[model samples]
Target: MIVKTSRPAARLAALVLPLAALAGMGTAAQADDWTPTSAIEFIAPANPGGGWDTLVRTTSRVIQEEGLADQNFAAINVPGGGGAVAWAQIARDTGNPHKLFATSPPIILVPLAGTSQYDHTNFTPIARLITDYSIVLVPRDSEYQDLNDLFDAIRENASLSVGGGSAPGSMDHISIAGVASAAGLEAADVNYIAFSGGGEAMTNLMGGHVEAVITGAGEAAGQLGPDSEVRALGVSAPERLGGPLADIPTYQEQGIDYTFDIWRGVMGTPDMPEEAVAYYEELFAQMLETDGWADARDQLGWIDAYQNSEEFGAFLDEQKEEFSEVLSELGLIR
Candidate 1:
């Protein structure tokens, strides 16, 4: 016998057809589509008033002010574990396509030091925005004349107590270790003290809390500003930086062939939609074209080293390998 379908069933089939079509359209829109329907959440992965926080906020502000995104981008602070919390959060939000995390060598260094749970593979790289070099800073009237004098002191006493703006196992400490190892001292012999940020570290230095500061150039640059009291001994770059810090010498120039540039970049959760990554890269590229970005870069004394996903991925891989050895030598890891 033949059975006839009811009107309700027919109506349900009609509704299902439109829903399926809409779902297909949504999927298509998500794949290879660059439209941003929502404001991207730029996770700073650090506390306010620090380097990473400032970097993300500046980028987000420029993006919103310059109309780079459909809506205004916002930054959320998730500081802890030396960026492990934010890394895990972004890693779990795979395919979100709306979230981005501000990151640098600290992201990898923390994990490699076994202090953080999240690793580099947990996220997708969007783009590397700029490069921040490390600097050796000392009190203005200190007896240590230059990089050589500091190394000579370090050679005499491995426990010279070099303070930094980051935590004990973070980038600041790692960079100090790298410098010491380059200066004929074992990484494990170097004494490193952690400071929350450079400003506080400088205060501590002036108060005689620490002998010297191995911090970011951006942080030490202001020390050489007009009416400043401290002086930068040397920078960790292939060559000298421009502007107010231009006259500063490089460690390599002073017979130390070593340089470290921390590439600050944006990252997304694993499996993030390709379209979203591309959209962010494009928006960031556009953001870089603005005077705001240039002003921020110069103001921060950052080296503009822009690179997209693949290049950043390769760079990250190379960095991880390099840090792995450094960490091992420092006894931070096996």
Candidate 2:
């Protein structure tokens, strides 16, 4: 689930100051001191075709297209255990400056759910690149017309099942649970069925086997169009997105007073050199400034929410604590 907590502007500036200094935005010597000496390994902890895979591949493509990096980027898939397998490998490569991976809410959620031994604290945070929100959908002919309609029905009928792409207590489930709680429903009591992926969940919804499905807004976009079988009830974004998704209203717009964003970023092996972290921070900052990255982000329905290493690290800690409370509330803490 995506939650946006307000950080004071002064606090945010303080968090960013060290990263700006390391990037040589306020200095010069540091940026010249660090550059990858060989091909960089970009790891996607999930199988190809999933969100992590898309992020790693798209970032590599954008960097190469924009000439943002001098070294070749090798996108590697290390799929397993909801990122646990890759995190284990990364832990074994501590201090390896040439290795980095795509990261998101799962990095925090899965571990807290006791499915993994490694968490965000095991890695050196590089930067947070983009944010995406969850989309709640139902079959085109379903009776639920909006988020309230769906939640009201679920509340009235405890047996009604909701489905999501992630594991029971992970991203997709947590997303809807958050909204359910905000809508005055008992989040822990909501029947959530887990699917292997959003595609599978969507299939079940289209087949009339599930009451509703929650998945990434980008993933939902692929199935929603002029002649689609799924109808989006509400998105977790605070505001409406552009392009084909502009017509979909946010939960806030529908008076739900809820928001969630799935943040994706890059992080390195533990004990990675400060210089390497600084190098990636500067490289990603440059990448975000390029037209190539902007175009890629827009096409993928990603919102730009860049945060340097220090800032991203702080954000991860806050998320860990926030999610702990949420999971505990939902009785999913392991």
TM-scores of all predicted structures = 0.83, 0.82
Q: Over the stretch 1-334, how does candidate 1's per-residue lDDT look in tens digits?
A: 9999999999999999999999999987776577767777888776665567777888988887777777767888887666776787788787887788888888788887776778778888899998889988888888898888987887788767888767667798888788777877777777888765555566778888788988778646655875777878889989988877898899899888788887788888897777777877887888889988888788778877888987898999999998888777678773
Error of 2 at 163 (Å): 2.7
lDDT of 2 by residue, 1-334 (tens): 9977667876898889888776766346654578899999999886665577778888999999989889998999887676788899999998999999999898999899988888999999999999988988998889989999988888788899998766667888788899988888888868999765565677788887889998878656666788998889998988898766888999988888889999889999999988888889999999999999888788778889999999999999999999999899888887
Compute the lDDT of residue 32 as modeled in candidate 1: 55
Q: For candidate 1, which ten residues in a row score worst on lDDT?
A: 218-227
Could you tell me how far off, in angstroms, the CA of residue 191 lies in candidate 2 after the best superposition?
A: 2.3
Estimate the TM-score for candidate 2: 0.82
Alpha-carbon shift of residue 145 in model 2 (angstroms): 2.4
| Model 2 stretches astray by more than 4 angstroms | 1-33, 156-159, 196-200, 203-209
Quote the lDDT for 316 in model 2: 99
**Highest-TM-score candidate:** 1
lDDT of 1 at 190: 73
Candidate 2: the clashing residue pairs are 2-260, 2-261
Instruction: Provide the RMSD of all predictions against the true structure, rounded to 1 decimal.
Output: 6.2, 12.2
